[model samples]
Target: VLPHDPSMRPVWMMRIGLFLYDHLARREVLPASATVDLRHGEIGQPLKPRYSKGFAYSDGWVDDARLVVLNAVDARERGAEVLTRWRCADAQRAASGWQVTLQGPGGQERSVQAKVLVNAAGPWAAQFLREHAHIQDSKTLRLVKGSHIVVRKLFDHQTAYVLQSPDRRIIFVIPYEGEFTLIGTTDVEHNGPVGQARIAADEIAYLCEQASRYMRQTVTPADVVWSYSGVRPLLEDEAANPAAVTRDYQLELDTRAAPLLTVWGGKMTTFRKLAEEAADMLAAPLGGSRGAWTQDAFLPGGDLSGWIGTAQRPDGDFQRFEQALTLRHPELSEPMARRWARAYGSRVELLLRDGLGEVVAPGLYEAELRYLHEHEWARTADDVLWRR
Candidate 1:
């Protein structure tokens, strides 16, 4: 955390939280937090001289879109039909189960009878219940738009900086795509449609101004190359501030007729646990097993066969895996090979099994595009560029 004007509560509170966190959990992957002299090292070099003292902490990052795609792939491999670009237009209680009308692209619709219905839509959970299922929900969703901006690389080091703004909020400046710095996120109240979320001009200026406070290099709105925003469906707790709203989720099961599970206000970090609990809740009603099978299971493309490092130290394993991937595909460029290995993990072999086909773009090839379309349900150019 960065140093601010007068109050040190944020820093001290962070230290105390880190202390409790280090003692509370089995921290085998990342190291514990510590006090650091930012003036002496690369971490401090990027910041202004006035901001000399700070705290350092560790956290892991994940490709969220890739994680969702991999989960779908794992489910499809386990005999679950994974459909993309499909929506539940209508859901009604049938004699045996739920009579759901699924609408697809080109205005085509299909009907399916599901024993149990799960409304796991992120921001549209309440809307789905009200509009499609014709059920009114008592709970409210406070839509908060979190915006982020990407700019040219700021610091040379790989360490991410968590800057405390004058408003007491924190923004992260992390390395992105090996060429840019990803900075974000503003939690502003959003009243527009969920899918229409876009980074506002003011949000961009705010991020740039906040980030420029500490960094030696001032961040300006002109420096931002790209920006995006997502509306968070947070559980409304009547908090006066949008940022103060709770992120925890609630699972509501309506067994009035057929079982309908409505998942409300959850972040991606606790998705697995939420899914497990949701499954367990519906297990008895659906006559399915109640075992927590996903607790020890690996997501698709997560297994590294020749891994030499434990869960605590997995960096070396991936480095070695990348090396092996490069060795196998000597014809591929080092950057391309490493990107594929990082993106697909051990499943890179499956991606390259058919051999690299025609070059579709500068770095993108036809084989990878085909694999994404066939396996990851990628259809549009935006899907390929932004998602897979």
Candidate 2:
């Protein structure tokens, strides 16, 4: 789920929440809501809204929180070779020239002769070396489990709340998409594969209890619409509380056998920075052709000539730039169009390739699909539905 701020939450959560509040909210800012009711009715907090509902946009709008799909989509865009279900490196040394052993779509096999190689397989970073690279005594990475609970929207206001749980862990009541409030994030030690992770029932109860403090409504397991769990591969730190563990990333390089770089403790929001660093390290060994350049560069659709739209002051001087994109392109509704604008930034104009012409398609088109398919390696429809 997205967070209202990044002071405590992971960087990725902040990015998603910032994007949502920027384009979706009519007021352009999330207003704080005060609770008036805290009682739990017979069936507990009402399961569904009793009255009719209205929407700012149609159902199934894009920009939902689905990081897995978004990452896959981005990996494809950056021309990175991605393997879905891959095997361990097995501690074997890669041969000199570029080697390619095609197994199946489920696995990946490639050889690299770089001055540096990055191992960012989440929990499997240590295991990759233990099994494949013949590197003895690999550093430890303490795994942590973070879980979230999804429930019906808790407030009429468009803003999300970043509440402090009793345990001092933070929980967010974000306006997820349009229908539900996404809450969660409890960090505990993990001892299993990240893929096998699942949210525990107690975690749900804990989240509900914590949320009940700031909210007027009482949430429970029954009120939960959905839940998710993920494993964070954190740098081994002896901190007492998992919540207090450092969120910064660390890198280790071993030039003994071949160059082996292992990554630990990183989040989705910082992936861009991580990737650029990895590229710079690998470039020297792979033949340095380009210098480091990413911080200021815009992502796929983020290029803007000026900061979006401008407003005039009483004296006709420019004062502010509000989102009036819908005024120009009537094809997209305010929210969806704005989603494209913020997520893609100035790049939204590229989606309007025809330029001031009618929109031939409502949602996605063939050109877009082909671009994702060829450049982005989008194997499923969810990649576009969730990430694009």
Candidate 3:
């Protein structure tokens, strides 16, 4: 459902441009629903209503949190050194390269040499630049706190709300995790540490008050099942409004001596594009790289989209794959087959070759634990459960 007011009429141009770009980029940004009807109780009638093209909910969560694992594994397979649970302790300019020391969890330290240094540190990028790299005149970062709360399901339909508060700020009320309605967010200046961002009493109240304006029922702090907050290190724009700060990123390369590159504010949605741009800038001085080839590379278990027999009709590929997998292995239930395909993709057969098991936990499997340790380097329960 699209919510419109007099102030947001200009967004039609942006929506058109976005749809056009999505088409040109071969990405499906809108569903084929063609229109959303407010007459249906699935969607609420807004005070000043506007219309949009899509009325579908895409299951985009499976590929999100696991992406970090996929990236680390892919990098390791490509001969890139990956050190986990290690902290960068020192960085010094050297004659041939930069001298760096990493402190491991055991309090042991190791030093390495690298021709170039990259600061992809999210919230601590500026501090790391000054303290470690000693870079001067660095770009400033405005740390803004964004918070979200998940309450009992607000609506029964797939339709979500893009609500505009009286103060003209926008908050989204999207269906989340099957049983919750996710509402957010607040834009407040943050001075706390990155990891210490917390949902303040005022932030929670603000979210509840804003979302309750349009939802069928009023939401309160008592309805919140879960909540989280993060400090976004936005590129410092001297706008008095924190929400008005632009999210566009910047890539800065310092080559006065050894090469040092720092990536400023960037969004995870465009991270691969940002990385490609960063690589393009660093290619020349670093004796060039294998020209950009990551545009079509799939994550670890994302190859399910490429299964055959559904190239022309790839919409039901996941269901079809689950069916085929069930047929191949009669031992697996339909739900288990679907889970295997989703968690392992093309590696399902290999992962199941060792035989299915009696349950180890509710959704955890003994065989899966073996797979995680043998393949994904998961040593602890948190590593397997949290990172996956």
The CA lDDT of each predicted structure is 0.87, 0.59, 0.75
Per-prediction TM-score to the true structure, in the order listed: 0.96, 0.67, 0.85
Against the true structure, candidate 2 has what lDDT?
0.59
Question: Candidate 2: where is the Cα deviation over 4 Å?
Answer: 1-91, 94-102, 106-115, 269-291, 306-328, 346-375, 386-388
Which clashing pairs does model 3 show?
none
Error of 2 at 387 (Å): 4.9
lDDT of 2 by residue, 1-388 (tens): 2112223455455446555755675442233222222133222132222211111111212343433545554566778667654544444445542222334555656543434456777777777666655455546778889999999888655545556454556676667766788887888788877689899988998999877755657887899989988888887778888777778887665556556667777876677788777776666556765876766554454334364434223112111121545666676766566455545545455556644344325656564565555544567877666545
Worst 10 residues of 1 by lDDT: 305-314
- Residue 75 miss distance in model 3 (angstroms): 1.1
By lDDT, the candidates rank as: 1, 3, 2
Error of 3 at 325 (Å): 3.7
Q: Clashes in candidate 2: how many?
A: 11
Ranking by TM-score: 1, 3, 2
Q: What does candidate 3's lDDT look like per residue over 1-388, in tens digits?
A: 4454445545565366446644666445334322344544446543223332223322233345567777887888788888888988889998997999999989999999998998999879998888777766548999999999999887676557767677878898887755789999999999877778899999999999987766658889999999988788799989999999988888889898888889899877778898898888889768968878888786666576444353333447666777777777787766667666776876675567687665777767677878878777788888887666
Candidate 3 residue 236 C-alpha distance from true site, Å = 0.3
